[model samples]
Target: MFATESGGVRRNSLKDFVNVKANGKIAMKLADGDKLVRVRTCTEDDDILLSAHGGKCIRFPVTGVRVFVGRDSKGVRGIKLAKGDEVIAMSVLRHVKVGVEERDEYLAAVNAARRLKGGDYTKRAEDKARDEELAAKLNEEKFVRMAEEEEYLLTIAADGLGKRSSAYEYRIAGRGGQGIANIDLARGKKKTHVAAAFTVLDSDQIVMVSDSGQIIRCSIDKISIVGRSSRGVSIFNTADGEQVVSVSRLRDVNGDDEEGDEAEEVENGGPEAEAAPQGNEEGEEEPPEVDGAGEAEGDKAGGGEEETP
Candidate 1:
């Protein structure tokens, strides 16, 4: 799967690259000034979520994109962008069939539980009783099932604020439509734009980099989970004139299987980092091998061969 910043998406089979050389082959032809933003492994049953810099996101089924037979052609539109808005991230999540009523009920229960866990004893008795009632209305088995399929989307703003929102808040819609608000852009005093938006696991760690070369790494669980359109709390504190430009998620490798562990080790170096031997016999350094495919800017096509889903 290849997703572009301009909302183009391409789906190709793994077998299509069976004979690909070390130089690599063109996975998808991109338009002028458009760059590939993601190359994640996905199944037909999964859903593709595209997040734009203007704080908008669209969710649609993977089946909405037809499997490409050639790599020279650009793919179909995954979302419609407003003027000057470009996609910042593309994430693939499991496709879960949840009704509107069920989703509302689950969210209510989850929010109530979160408030209860906060231990805010200063709340009025009626408010506490109402939260308890909402929590009790949730079916244990159904809640467990929803939890299994639930995904959290971590969205970061250029102004150093971020939050995790339930994926259920993003309703499934047809491809190539204007998306709903991903975050409240007007909630802050300073005008801000989305720096990064992608699905993350609670156990994952995130590293944020600012334009001033400042970096901050923290546990994903520390971020508060809030409504999709709500303004998030500060996750990073950028200095004056600085803005967050990049964010990366590091998976929890401790409990992974052998293959998963090896993959994570390779990913830590980055998608373009080669797995070749380090030094030569003379103890001198060797130049890294370059792939034939290149990006318009410095943005690397995310996920290398080992990361293919």
Candidate 2:
């Protein structure tokens, strides 16, 4: 897995990591004031989505990043930050090919369904016109199949309000461009920005933590799924003076798989590293040394190390 820092990224090989000493080795160097914020495993085909507290986001394919021989190089810019904005979260998504018109129609259908569920089914001429246009362009059977394979993104604000939006709500863009809004903050009485946003599954649960140390867990399915720009529902009730500090997805504990088990072993200092396969057909590898000037590593930060394939 790769841990994204405010200024750069730290990465280690999954195969060779098992052979390293329990103390761990240098992964990526960083700038003096920068620190790690997020970690995610990546594949060549995966797209990286970086979210900022200012409601802007950037998406770029993983292959766009260069694989450095050493951990010392400062990583490339993943997003163009506003004057005071900084990255708070990063998510990996599978690449999907779809037309813009089709995606728009799908979102319209979802929004209409949500409106009906919320008891706002009043008829409108424009709504009818849009639906008719959508019906003529989308194949019902094909759209249903795509929806079955689609993933939804859940974004929560510090004020305890949250929403689930289709993954397609975020369009893929080049690295370092000012991104589109991840959620609407001006919809309701309270004015607050997004605290956390990540991909979620219907069967998943979420744990929201408050600034006052209060924590609440809710089923992902219970949260109202809505349009990307719509106002969200209240998923957690914070104390009068409290605000949610963080939100995380929870999966079934019994559903742990091989990768999860490996992560656990690494966390507990298990000796599976000694048994882990070493260099492939090649012999002992040399320590990598990066030549360019970039973000420099600082004093160690507190966290367990992760190795990615």
Candidate 3:
């Protein structure tokens, strides 16, 4: 017999339930991890009851709504969706919490489902093996979830290093009592393979006032924030891929923008400041957020203080 993954197994196994009826008869058996669909309901008691049974439920404005249906996909045999009982997938809710994680999970699940229906299992033994494979695939996805925190802090150690005159300078002006105690990555910040360096401007008062009121600058390179984590500011070498700075190294920087101060913010956390950070508020775009669960081995990787607001 061919291997289950060779397309022969799934197709062979589906011989039993291959012809799933999706008409108004209501014979669908929900999968083990059936997504919780939000629907309009009528009462709190009803909502709780449906949720407890793993059935989708939602309150209608104020009234708690619930739909008593089968645990499987076709729903109950005779029972049907009630008026205002809209079935919306919980996938939407999960996405709002962490789009990346939810997206990854959905992809993994879909791949597994496809593998399940691929082979032609004309025999009982083939069916058993297919089911086992599908179960294993789903079980594996339980571990690859995304995380949530998106802020970080990096230590500013270099002075006037990696300076470029071409692009505009990205300056974070210090605020009142904000004493560069630490560098904040701010939420929605993302880390990428394309690297940049943060430098502190130097002068005669370098050693003395250097601790505060000095302009802290970050040189960005790329324009993408692909696969980042939610840890606070932590620096890494652009070439060797080694982490370098951190938040505790944060110190005071120069004051916030003046009436005529003209430096621009980094665009999309990119090294090249040819353009202003997309939004008005500085690098607060879609910072790579992970809920602290999926810290990648590498290619996952921040900021300094003694800077301005």
Candidate 4:
């Protein structure tokens, strides 16, 4: 799956580019000012989440897009953007069937338990009592099932504030529509924009880099999980006029594991895995090889580089 900054989405079969040479083949033809924002491997049952710099995100199923017959075509719209908004990140999430009432109940119970565990005493006595009662009514089996299927999303702002939110907070919607608020940008006095948004695991570590060349690495578990629309705590303290430009996840390495995961490939926007070249079969067209001279010329002709996400 390939997504562009202009909300275009394209899904092509892996067999389309068999026997790719040293120079990669053109995956999709982008629009005049559009650039590739994300590329991820996904299944038909998975949901695609697109996040914009304006703190808006839209989640839609992968089945919403049809497989393209050729790689040269520009795909269909994935999310509608506002006047000054552009997509920053894309993530693939598992599709789960959940009811509105069930989700509300689960969230209430979870929040109550979290507050109780943190020893929150700012609420009124009656409110605390109600929260305790709600926490006590949590269904153990249902909580366990929901926890097993839950995914956490980490969203960072350019001003260095960030938070972890449950993926369930983002409800699936139709493609080509303005999305719900991803973070609370209006709560702060200073103007801020979303720097990055992606699904992360508890054991994952993240490295953030600022435009001024400052870098900070922190454990994902240290970030506090909050409501979807709440302003997050500061994860990095940037200097004057500094802003975070990039964020990358570092997976925990397990020495005892028999099967190792593939190394992540860094691209224009973020980390993405390139499709491996497959052997050609009979009657298959061979990919054209690009000489070093032609490759440099081709890049020069491409013109206008993509902005770093």
Worst 10 residues of 4 by lDDT: 274-283
lDDT of 3 by residue, 1-309 (tens): 000100000001123234567664322233343332222212222111110011111111111111212222222111112222212111001112334554455444444555565645566677657565644545443333322211111122112111111001111221111111111223234322111212222210111112223333332221111111112222222233222222111223343331322221111111211111112211212233222211222323211111110
Candidate models: Cα lDDT each: 0.72, 0.59, 0.22, 0.73
Per-model TM-score on C-alpha atoms: 0.79, 0.72, 0.14, 0.79
For each predicted model, how many residue pairs clash, with residues at least 3 apart or on different chains? 1, 4, 53, 0
List, residue by residue over 1-309, the lDDT tens digit for candidate 4: 888887667777777778999989888777698888889989998999888777778888887665655677666677766665778888999997888788878888889989888775785788789889888757678777987899988899887899999988888876766677888776344666788888888877777888788888787899999998787999999976677888877785454333233223222233222111121111112232222111222234323222111
In model 1, which runs have C-alpha deviations exceeding 4 angstroms? 119-123, 187-189, 253-309
For residues 1-309, write the lDDT of model 1, one tens digit per residue.
Answer: 788877677787777778889999877776678888778899989999888777788888887665655566666667766656777778888999999889999999999988888857575888899999888766688877998889999899887899999999988887767777888777444657787788888888777888788988787899999999888999999877677877877775464332121111101111111111211112112222133232122334421111111
Better of 1 and 3 by lDDT: 1
Please name the candidate that would achieve the greatest lDDT relative to the true structure. 4
Candidate ordering by lDDT (highest first): 4, 1, 2, 3
What TM-score does prediction 2 earn? 0.72
Judge candidate 2 against the unseen true structure and give its global Cα lDDT, from 0 to 1: 0.59
lDDT of 4: 0.73
